[model samples]
Target: MAKALHPTQVIVRPLITEKAARLAEENKYAFQVHPDADKTQIKDAVEKVFGVKVVKVNVINLQRKARRTRTGHILHGQRWKKAIVTLAEGHKIELFEGV
Candidate 1:
């Protein structure tokens, strides 16, 4: 069986961006989560850490992109996972409130 991760380990950080802000208005929030974590783990982590009811969870795998340096070499960016969590209608996470 796979080892379970703690809530803190599952959630890397809150994604604070223009798009995230707009989603928050509709009771949805975005978080940068552990790439290995699944949708159910993300849902449980969000609920446990934020103390909110999770209505739905959506995940997106952001692939690495290749970029060239000024000198000459090409490098690839790191791959990460993003989770868009929709909370229950009356619930809200305070962290996104002021942003």
Candidate 2:
């Protein structure tokens, strides 16, 4: 069984990239999400926080990246999950409108 998650914890933040912005036009919005969150949890979180009806949720697990700073310092990025949330055909998430 999946553990319950607060709406805020489930959705870490909205993803703002050129690719994600384009997808938003088609009623699909992307977000950085909790690593342990599943599709169901993501869908519910989006709906509860955005006041929009979610039709589908697709998840992608991201691998940590290895980075080397100019000073030769090694920095390891944390692993996280990304969720693509598709809203109902006629509905939209207003938060992305002005962005």
Candidate 3:
């Protein structure tokens, strides 16, 4: 994170799932972030892209999972990082509101 990265490049996409849906109630939102992006980058990206104040940032590295193909060959999934961003109270991302 030496040089600043664009918000779009820093944050890959929003992580929409049952677990994430539940966490949203507490002002915490999940996102699929670039592997090279750190917590600080994540916080900056979320704030710039979503126009919301970020309270905290938590990140996790998701390991690549192996999947068997039809011919029994192993296919490895891509390794990516996840960011759980907590926003300041009363601030919201419209993209997450059933969009």
Models 1 onward score TM values of 0.94, 0.90, 0.91
Tens-digit lDDT track of model 2 for 1-99? 777889899999999898998999999999999988889999988988989999999999999999999999999999999999999978998878866
Winner of 1 and 3 under TM-score:
1
Ten contiguous residues with the weakest lDDT in model 3: 1-10
Candidate 1's displacement at residue 32, Å, is 0.3
Clashes of each: 0, 0, 0
Please name the candidate that would achieve the greatest TM-score relative to the true structure.
1
| Steric clash pairs (candidate 3) | none
lDDT of each: 0.95, 0.91, 0.90
Native-to-model Cα distance after best TM-score fit, residue 11 in candidate 1, in Å: 0.3
- Residue 6: error of model 2 in Å? 1.1
